[model samples]
Target: MERLLVVLCPELLEEQEDGRAARTFAGVVEVVESFSPAAGAVRPGVCAVPTRGPSRYFGGDVRLAGLVRTALSRTDTALGRVEGHIGVADGLFVAVLAARAAGDEPVVVPAGASARFLAPWPVEALERPELADLLRRLGIRTLGAFAALPTRHVLGRLGTQGSVCHELARGMRSELPGYRLVPRPHPATAATGDGSAGAQVRQAGFWGEAAEAEARAERALGHLEQLLPPDGVAVGRLQGGRGPAERARLVPWGGRRLDPAGPGPEPWPGQLPAPAPASVLARVPASVVDGRGAELEVGPSGLPSAPPEQLSVRGGPWQPVTAWAGPWPVDERWWSRRKRRRRARMQLVTSCGMAYLVVREDAGWWVEGAYD
Candidate 1:
């Protein structure tokens, strides 16, 4: 788990139509960057700095916190009366809670004391509603209680997600799911009045070997750009949606480069669980049938008429469905009679060892995508 110092400004969390919060938060990030060059915005009004280096330079975590708070106080009157809460802990998750618990002074959880510091927090602090509800029902209301449960039992009961949360409760993991946002360049290092080309020229390479590798990669990309048509070079950018296809878009390269390694889109209400499919295909016609070779269909209640037995893509020979999950219903634009849509999606694994995502509409089944 990486030790982090979280800076949260309650006043600048919510964005207004005028984007005042964003601008104010940018100023806050700038101030923190002055202390540590690695400070990054986790979200609007929430930023984190890796404390290892900065703590050493500033004499210690406590003194570092005090110095930051003093600096922020000096900027409050100039930058819309900002109230900053600082917390230093072993991980991002606990550090955020420490920040929230802070008052006028910074909260510093001792090194190697993350589990003890987190023991008293509610299981709800894990921010997983379904798991929290289950734990509450099982009389496991506190993080300590959840952590005490046998790992095998938790994994058996809740699967991978439960195991992950259990690790968090035990302080084995530092970050909460979705805590990271896409990395946006700091305003000071971003494109200046000179041009976007200046931004590209300012590559980040901490070592000589890495710098040489980056230069080689840049040269290769430059050659590729000259060889390929403008539309041939593209990259994927994430967007908000429930399905893999809807959540990503392919944009022409040489614009803003979005890091694929960054965190995914924020969780959507009806989104499929992760390990997203490896490929998203156009809606291709497919055939699905039950054991008796009867076509399967989804009813108005979104339940399948019969269990899926086999699938055939584009009239290909049927492959036996070895496993399947879901009739995850889609009811969009429900308030509007004319625009309302009703559909269901299912994951099917065939005997050929291939998995596919298929959707059922009023017309019939269509293959939406496939998994690796």
Candidate 2:
């Protein structure tokens, strides 16, 4: 019912790791939905977490803030003097602005007094360079000065961003509807036969779906044996059959692309460097049928196609798509959009990290999924 405590590390922008550290940092606060990079190199990390649960569980917001401080400060040495600061306010945007202002040191805006606390700060507190410049040109240097200016003039001059800057400069935050995080299951959708024969066969989910797909792709790409590095190293990954495709979003909304080279605490491949996190597509079943009619059924034989047009997934920094199945065509009613189903479809996954399926609608072939 109160404000969420936001913890920040200005220097965190320099830490070149995956999103895990940034996510873990938000976990220090509450449920971490996702982390967004403001600008330069995904650095300048900012995490948003709910405060009610932590404040209640920890007895109070002040204590919760202290706990966050302890968690962030308790890190490995040699990371340099990276200070983690905590700021508490009525909302996330305000807390972020306040946290940025109190850099390298902790500060908590008193409950219900966020507006008062932000009144004296500079217009740059909102961090919009262009808007800040415009405001300065208009002689509005401080939050108090901006607040004194008319809202109509603000909006007319700067558009929506101006309205946002004004609201945030006054400790007001845009209300974001709360949403839930969907779970991403590992990819290995394998079909294994029973010890006796086909009728007794069963398919078990593999532990590492990404690796399996990658291996399958690498094997399929054996045709390019000479192109492969002597070490069988891979270049990148693909999401559909041998040909190019498009993307589709199902029940799960937005996905966090893991940057192997981004700001994470742990190194990828243990000591070896890793690539930055990027967006991955989710592989969702377009249609389902009885076992007898399943395309890539629970049996071992997944959808396999000819060598030329087959898309393979290879692992390394990128992957390739080897084979494809389905167009086991399906169509479903889009409840939200209230649209009737019309496209034919199938699924594709490659070794590296791309997961997709093709829609054979009149529009030709289009991709519909990628796993994160």
Compared to the true structure, candidate 2 yields what TM-score?
Answer: 0.38
lDDT string, candidate 2, 25-96, tens digits: 334323222211221111224544566666677777677666666656654434433466667777655666
How many pairs of residues collide in each model?
A: 0, 47
Error of 2 at 300 (Å): 83
Q: Estimate each model's TM-score.
A: 0.49, 0.38
Off by over 4 Å in 1: 77-79, 180-372
Give per-residue CA lDDT, model 1, range 1-372, as digits (tens): 567788998876655446577788888988999999988776666788889999999999999999989888888533577999999998777888889889989999888787788889998888778989999999999999888888658745764457667777777766554433223444533444434323322322232234346446545655676687644667788988887899998765433222232576678889999878898988899999998898999888878889999999999999999999998999988999999977799999999899999999877999998997
Overall lDDT per candidate, in order of appearance: 0.78, 0.45
Candidate 1 local distance difference test against the native: 0.78
